[model samples]
Target: MKRKRTISLNSSSITTRSKTRAAAAAAAAKFYLPDDCWESVFKFVINDKSKFKNRRYLNSLSLVSKQFLSITNSLNLSLTIYNGSRPFLRRLFQRFTNLTSLDLTWYDRDLNKLLCQISRFPLNLTTLTSLTCSRVDSLRSGDMCLIADCFPNLQLLDLSYCSYVSEEGILQVLRRCCKLRHLNLANCSKIELHGMNFEVPNLEVLNLSRTSVDDETLYMISQSCRGLLQLLLRSCYVTERGVNYVIENCTQLREINLRGCCKVHASFVASMLLSRPSLREIIVPSLRHFSVTEREFFKRHICLVY
Candidate 1:
């Protein structure tokens, strides 16, 4: 006859055997707290602006019980994908089932494969990254469709320092991800002035800083992105005519950053003040010859001239 494993119900086992008792407690759920209640407590702990860090609190909670571990795992919605995280990608995704935003700036592996792995989960990606993606493989035009298909609700996309993101890929993104609002194409060297005729009707904030964007590109942007609120063209090749065109056409433009566009003159500030009365902020390359009225104007409006 096959022998069956038996549990020791002795006094010694009851006092000293932690594993058996812990397992029994978890299985029994004697004082089972509701998941939602635990979630609320966790949120309060995490959102506390006090001196104690939330990570330490969570680490302590995770060790309390299996239920606590599962609840903590579910609370994790954002993850930073790096080269070291590649091997444990499957396990990580399984643990953090409700992940949304992902930062891949530190990722140096195959971008396509990583994206494919991410696509398996329906994550609502909408956020930023401190570091730029210069090390990873360039996201191709074909991959844009895959990205849009997976994360169609993506509102904010930070592709800064991704120099090889072609204009066609951009067009693909605009075509598919219609809900896209904030697009960070900063330092994308391959973005040329010509053949970018697509419109961004839903786009609100655009960062084209340190790119090869010229007058024609600005003109195109002026017509296409009329609903645009903020335009960052810092260190771009845009001229006076281009800037003026944008100021005229982009009616709702609240802020414009021309801090490094050497082609734009200081005199254009006066023109901007006269033309766009609704302008809240204007980051100009240089400012001079400010009258008392102009100083008052600067005070009234938050204009930053550098």
Candidate 2:
């Protein structure tokens, strides 16, 4: 009986020591790592290339601890709202205070109401750099002015397929948004540009595809936006002369889309391709005019997209 009791006491002492060690380890894990270190780790993990993986990892991390949840919320800078309501917009602004980019391309609602909500709220959106409201047909000149007022620090604005926004609205944007770099007015057929000496010096990428942008407008673009890198003039009214002028003046131009631009002939394109070594890609409608050797030569220097 004595021997058995001694053995039982020894087993109890071992069990108690094991439980104490485990409790100490749990405490260490809970308090050892600093918040900044954890923030860096979370940032690295959340910035994974695959969106699906990043979201999954973020969701799982948020459930790990309160610190993780706060970090996740603070680091989320980009947001895309498809069906945004006033209440929802308010909630989003409240939740993510550091939003730098917003995409409402898929938002199927009246922009006036949205703008009203923005105007009503004293939201700190100075950090916003990119805004895409593509296909929002109801956006008028007044709406563009409102956007300029709200997002003064905007660098990239995509108003593609918003046919209702005319030259008045576009000019308003160009005048106000001086920091604008990339502007996409693709398929805005009604934008009428006469003899206006507008200049967007910082403007780099412009898409006037399928618009009635003629040589005069092209000349204005060449003069104003000299630093233009990529220009898309597909299906535009610009002729070979305009194309040549742009090529000669806009020395920084790398890629130009001339697809469906029926007036832009092959000879001008070939001459520009030979003259401008800076030209990287020229997307045309056809390559039938070029001989096999000529085609090979052109291909070696630049990308000939059909």
Candidate 3:
């Protein structure tokens, strides 16, 4: 009777072990992410389609299975065509659909036709949130307007070092992208404020450092972009009034950079700092120390600068 009992226990233990292994295998087979999910991850990782930094990894993914290859080849990814990439832009652009962002900062001044082709993406009559394109002289105002009209969801536009982009391009972007939050026009020498009216209610950060902005344009931007929080106007022509408007009206402003803006008066800068009690720091040409009284004034009186 003892031998029979021991044998029965052993048999039950073996049965339990086998059942657990089988259940685990079944769960893995049923609950794993489908092939389509993997494709989405791949698309998000490679925002720039023209040249992926990890070519070896992408190639390995392509070899995983036919299903993956199908998705990879499908038009459901964001694309970028860097200037020196081997494949043509046409072939690269033909593969992607549902693209939400694009970075085309790798062009050699031939963007007219390419801009037209890019305008055919998922966004229609809307602006893109992030556009890092190189401006071209050949691009007419109409072409620029068309490009701006394409990305309705544009929030951050980086036209840095694009010499071809003028005031018209800036205006076009500002007019179309009402929700623009960050505008980087660094080294865009042609952006002037004369006769320019922009309404960017959601603009929080604007970097026009080293650009050709006079006092009038700077003041205009101050009035239009009331929600501005941080502004960089280094080496630009900014007077006392322009500084006053920004410091007084943009109550949420934390940092105001006037490095190389030689026209700004010291008195105006002091007042700006005092008005915005919440201002943590100001990037001036020579910022060595702050007096106790100045600090106290800022802490006490700057709660209502706007």
Candidate 4:
């Protein structure tokens, strides 16, 4: 037997290599699941409860895995697109279906695509409550109607400095939004006294400072909105008649701003404030002197900061 065993170098080397290969295979087989099983391993990553830390983190996570990207992109809620972010806004509307609130303010007269995109919002018009439109000069009548029609449940509407909006556009909103309670039209140069005619039954607060409205509009408002509690009319064309109209009719009025209303007589305003104890704040340009009866009521809650 010993004489028959002839040791060959090639055969010996082959036997050694086989043992090493077997050991490596055994180690790899100890731990590892199939690809299908691995998918179910990270199921929590796709849940909507988990939110991205910040925008940078969101961008980074979107690149991590397909499941993460799908969930993150589907959960976008509030979106704000500034002047240069129009492209982002367009693409966002196309994909982001869960948008609840949107705020857009542009620097230039460029809202062609932005306005068009807003018309396609998926949610019911009655669900939206907040809106802020600024500096879209070419906005037409139809555009205003489209907006008012969409947000039938709008509670707060701020159209500050929207120069294109006329009486027609505003009337569309007043007619539709019965739930509207707060409205701000400061610096809206095109808005005249005629535009002030709105029947906001639930309206408790209003800001019409720096508009073209005069005492005639104020009188009309008192006759219409008896529930109006607070009104701001600084720097508009007003006189004693306007102030008198408000105090006589709008007894619920708690605060008013008459700053820079040079046409009004300070003495009359001082008298009205004393007569109406409900008047809490009266902002006037100047109050040189007051009658004894006026001083007693005026000093109650008058803040003459102007």
Candidate 5:
């Protein structure tokens, strides 16, 4: 009887140990990794060559756990929307509340409706620093004013190819968004600088490429944006006199793109290279009478892209 009782006790102990081992294995299989670990993994996954595949992986990760959803939301800093609907935009803003940069280039939608929807979410626009709404042809002065009102802390604004935005709209942005560091008004034909007196002291990079900007506009930019470093005036109406004015006033200018400016002579660019040691790049159209030696010398010091 004693031997049988001892065998039963030993068998019960063995069964308990096996159950504990099984429970430990199950717990290990369901272990949740830390958020930082998942973020590191996400970074690795996004480094893949295929963007679609990366997006798929990100979507899957977001659906895995609440922690993943939060990480994905914070990591999504820049977004590009093409012809987006109001409801879709609202959902995006709701998910990515900390979005810093947004690009709506070539959005073929109602400008007023989109702006109205964006205005409804002031919190989303408050943290936004960079905004690119290129080729928004319907963007008028009033629309620009609305943008300035909503996004007062905008540091970089690219309204390129927005031909409808007039001088008044441009002035409104410069005046309101005082923290603007980069402003692109490329192909904005109606933008004029006849009576503009406002200053953009922090403006470092300005792009007026393919615009109707004349010497007067250049002069205004030189006077107002004294800290101008990179200036793109490609296909603009600026003459050598205007370029000279910029070189004289914007002493900190590093790069200038004068491509397709037929009136700007290559000799003037060579002179600028000699005078402005800070000038690292000067992209001009092919020179007609530029000597090989002079070209080589300019190439050695600066990137003279033709």
Candidate 6:
């Protein structure tokens, strides 16, 4: 009743007549939209981190189609490395080639070797703009030099609370990072009391709080960093004379923190408020009282008196 059903007996065929009435079965594969759609989705996810943490979200997306993975990798511009993430640094660097900011605040490991590895990569000047290595116990002068050599174009560097860093280390940063706008050396007390003198014209915000920053260093800073917007000398041993030099030189200073300077007097601070119209905020020493005139003057000028 049925016509003859013939099958080819080609040896090259994966399935032959010997395997009768049988074939492999598979599920439907997932599909993806065009490149533009993937790009939009990647951007949305990268910006909306409420659903997934940054690295984890990216890692999950990378398991998708190749196009989606590529889009995610391209959209990732920042990375926060952990102490245990040292082994994967190379891979992370290779993937997030567009990183402009790196936060190493939590990483307390062998920073010298880590920096050496980062320097080897072909990262552009614009590849990294902001870097934070604050509170690093093992930071050294060589490490600071490595930072200058690796990311010379860094605009914001936070080296505050580091256990040890010599004047030479801080000096290297000021010299090599020509574009440095903000530098935090708070509590890096190991810096020499006299030798840290270098020019950083572009430096806008400098924190020398709780260090051995003497009047000479302060004067040198005033001369060098004239465009300073925020100068933090909290708990430093600087005097009214040194502070006077800063107020006179740094014409663009919007905020100054002089809290805890034993040598600075409130009368001098009152004079600063009266003289410097550009000041938006002033943090005077504790236990010092401001006169009614000083208070009224600061209020009149819209300057924050603390």
Ranking by TM-score: 2, 5, 6, 1, 3, 4
Per-residue C-alpha lDDT of model 2 across residues 187-236, encoded as one tens digit per residue: 99976465447778899999999887999888888788888999998888
lDDT of 2 at 193: 62
Off-target runs (Cα >4 Å) in candidate 2 are: 1-26, 29-31, 50-53, 299-306
lDDT of 4 by residue, 1-306 (tens): 554454565677788899889887888687645544543443344444433344444566668777556555655555567777765655676555555556655535445455666567564444457777765566656766877766778777777777877768777877788888777888887676565565667777778888888888788778767677888888888888777887888777788888778887665665666656577777765656556665655555563323
Greater-TM-score candidate between 4 and 5: 5
Error of 3 at 45 (Å): 11
For all candidates in order, the CA lDDT equals 0.75, 0.82, 0.69, 0.68, 0.82, 0.81
RMSD of each candidate relative to the true structure: 6.3, 4.4, 8.8, 9.7, 4.8, 6.1
Error of 5 at 53 (Å): 6.7
TM per candidate comes to: 0.78, 0.84, 0.71, 0.66, 0.83, 0.79
Question: In candidate 5, what are the lDDT values of residues 77-172, reduced to their tens digit?
Answer: 667777744568877888887778878786868777787778877454778899999988888778888889878899999998887878887788
Tens-digit lDDT string for candidate 1 (1-306): 123223434645666778788888988797677988999989986895542466567778989999899998877666677889987877887777776566777877677877787677554333211213443456777666667766776777788888677788777777777778888888887686466577778998999999988999888888888998999998898899989888998898888898889999866886786677667788886555667887776766666433
lDDT of 6 by residue, 146-209 (tens): 9999897899999889968767887888888899999888998865436546667898998889
- lDDT by residue for model 3 over 84-196, one digit each (tens)? 64235555544444445677765664567667666664434242356666554454567668666677677877777777676776787788877779888777777775655
lDDT score, candidate 3, position 175: 84
- Cα displacement (angstroms), candidate 1, residue 241, comes to 1.1
TM-score, cand. 1 vs. native = 0.78
- Error in Å for residue 56 of model 6: 6.3
Candidate 6, superposed: residue stretches over 4 Å from native: 1-66, 122-126, 287-292
Record all residue pairs in model 2 with backbone atoms less than 3 Å apart, i.e. clashing: none
Model 5 earns a TM-score of 0.83
